[model samples]
Target: MERTILMADGQSFYASIEKAAHPECRGKPVAVGDPTRRSGIILAACPVAKERGVTTAERVGEALAKCPDLVVIRPRMQTYISVSLLITEIFESFTDQVEPYSIDEQFLDVTGSLALFGSAERIARLIQTRVQLSTGVCARVGIGPNKILAKMATDNFAKREPGGISELSRANIEEKLWPLPVHRMFMVAGRMTAHFARMGLHTIGDIARLELGEFKRRMRARMGRQSDIQAEYYWQTANGIDPSPVVSGMRSQIKIINHGRALKWQTYRTFADIEPLMLELLIEVCRRARRYGYMGRVVAVAAAETDGQRSSGFGRQMTLPRPTYLEHELSSVVRSLFLTHWKGLPLTHLHITLTDLSRDECYQLDLFEDRSRLIRREKTVDAIKERFGATAVIRASSLAPTAQAFERAVQIGGHFA
Candidate 1:
């Protein structure tokens, strides 16, 4: 049976949400970021800002230079997540095979639903209308025989065309997809684009036309043993063929959990100033890890120093003696990394990442430490916090002047409640 995949992408997601919430900013050039921080960059820009040459990730100062009247707003991540969940619920109403590509994009395998929905294009139109009416945000929908074409159709044509819907199939591959530059092709990064250029493969058509033997030979020189796999995948994608399934219920595939924060105030000058903040972040990270029933062996700490002009940061990773989800173990490593790597710089941000994960159910006892007692203690603390509130149970250090636990507990993604 031919697969029918649809990609639905929220247009200028963050900025659109802001505009929808604040109707007065509909046609104005608005950018979202930390308005209080002069060095903060534009996280998202509205269509009007885009028209004025303001782009996301550019510094607020630069965006202001491009459009003097641009309005900068702080990000409200919780609001965005809520809206995204609502959108996903809408997708779920159409098909059980909905896969979230990101917070703002999702792919739905509606092949089975085609019998009930009538046609792919009809379903796309219905979804687009439903999203706009229900969420007050417009969405672009792309329909194709497979995932790759569906995504490309949405990105390359649907987003730009009127009515915000586009369809790509084998019939239209030559006319609509071939002439596009190699860089525009999915998964083709700058370095790979240069490799394609070196091989005189300028467009997707060039790749599609290459003989299998010749493609593998060239790819082998660049990608080693993985050349055969990469060559075939690239060639198939160039011809608009994707056999990958639209996986559903994908929460089990997550391998890492990370939490980071940029300080609202630059009070961190030494280890003493930053230790409490690090401890708070570590507790949060471990709490999340335990909640997910996962434990990590590798823990990484990153710190950024704020100068007058730009911020510079360094990161270091260390493997734990055992895979455990205790806050004390992770905090010890974090403190040690901070002490050894930090040169008493003015700190502005801190990040903690947990990787090399395994299921917590499989955790073995460590001979050196009372692992069971520590786990029970932390789990009790988690229960207390969960039952009352995040700030209900707190450490004495968190009450110190340098700590931000009390302040952050009320926040959703670094913004004030």
Candidate 2:
């Protein structure tokens, strides 16, 4: 056995979060998504739904075709995000080598922190228990000698046990992995699997047995140098030679709302989901506006279809009535900007951007508006909320969706939908 890393997969991830957050939707077939007329992408499906072949990225319409009684639920992106953050905080308590893989997935290079926590299984159990206790959600953990193997191992055995902490070792790899289909080796999703199958290379062990030159020559010779390099890297992964340690202090990147809805050959069915997603994006844009001490010269909303084609609308160079840094005021303008240009296409992704940047000045503030008082008051509110967290501060306008969305913003790197 080699020193191991741990991978935490959300165990049905989106669906699990939805079920955990909303108990009433637990038992039945629940699918979380935003079914806009333009793009009704399925984000997650619960365990029951999984049995019915309802999974993420299946369109609301296609899913219905498969299971007529399927229950589709609008996502609480904000809430999910908040839970994600809480999970992150909890993870930090255990190890510094935590790499956030996605909103709901993370990799813990617990090599150094092993002594403080004890064995890998102890830490895995600790993380699993704490997650269940803290968020009322259960996670499936995979422990192995490298990130890839750990992730794959978790996926292999996590859900079978009570609190999924599946371990993969040389013995298990030989017994369980070498025999499985090559497509089962992750990162081999989509077309990669098809290409391999056509060549009669059916198992990971089969692919591993071939010479690099023969492998490349036989496979239509399109495996790029990077792919070739990855092939070698994967052997290290299979043998568990990964030594990459986590590094921190990277600048926190800009926020993004990347929603992908499955489609009937890439088309949207409605517009409801995009509305909230756009609203969420606007919130981030405004928050950034305030942080940078200036209102942007442009407000833009762009939509990308499932195929990666995109279209966007540009707002007028509207100056803020009061050059302000308040989410309440700034988001109001952002909301207006988004709505005006929203034509509602089948968009898989909606992005709101603020550019043509400039600093704040007196001319931007409203003379009759008591601007200073409002901003000051809002600032106080922000400070209070920052201290006590989002649930403490709720504006009347944001009362409906803001609670879950805001909680997720500070706590989870959730896109506020």
Going through the candidates in order, what is the number of backbone clashes in each? Answer: 0, 13
Kindly list the per-residue Cα lDDT of model 2 for residues 1-417, writing each as its tens digit: 455688887766667777776787757887887655315888888778888888778788888778777777778878888888788778878876777788777888788788888889999888988988888767788988777778788766775767578887766776767677876776777687777777777877777667766675655455645566766654555444566655531225333322222233143325444445455456555555555455554554555544345544343334554344545554566567655655555555555556555444343556667767776675666577568765475544344442235645555545543
lDDT of 2: 0.65
In model 1, where do residues sit more than 4 Å from their true spots? 222-226, 251-417
Task: List residue ranges in candidate 2 displaced over 4 A.
Answer: 35-39, 65-69, 159-163, 198-200, 211-227, 234-239, 248-417
The estimated TM-scores of all candidates read 0.61, 0.55
How far out, in Å, is residue 384 in model 2?
9.1
> Least lDDT summed over 10 consecutive residues: which range in candidate 2?
256-265
Question: Against the true structure, candidate 1 has what lDDT?
Answer: 0.87
CA error at residue 262 for candidate 2, angstroms: 51
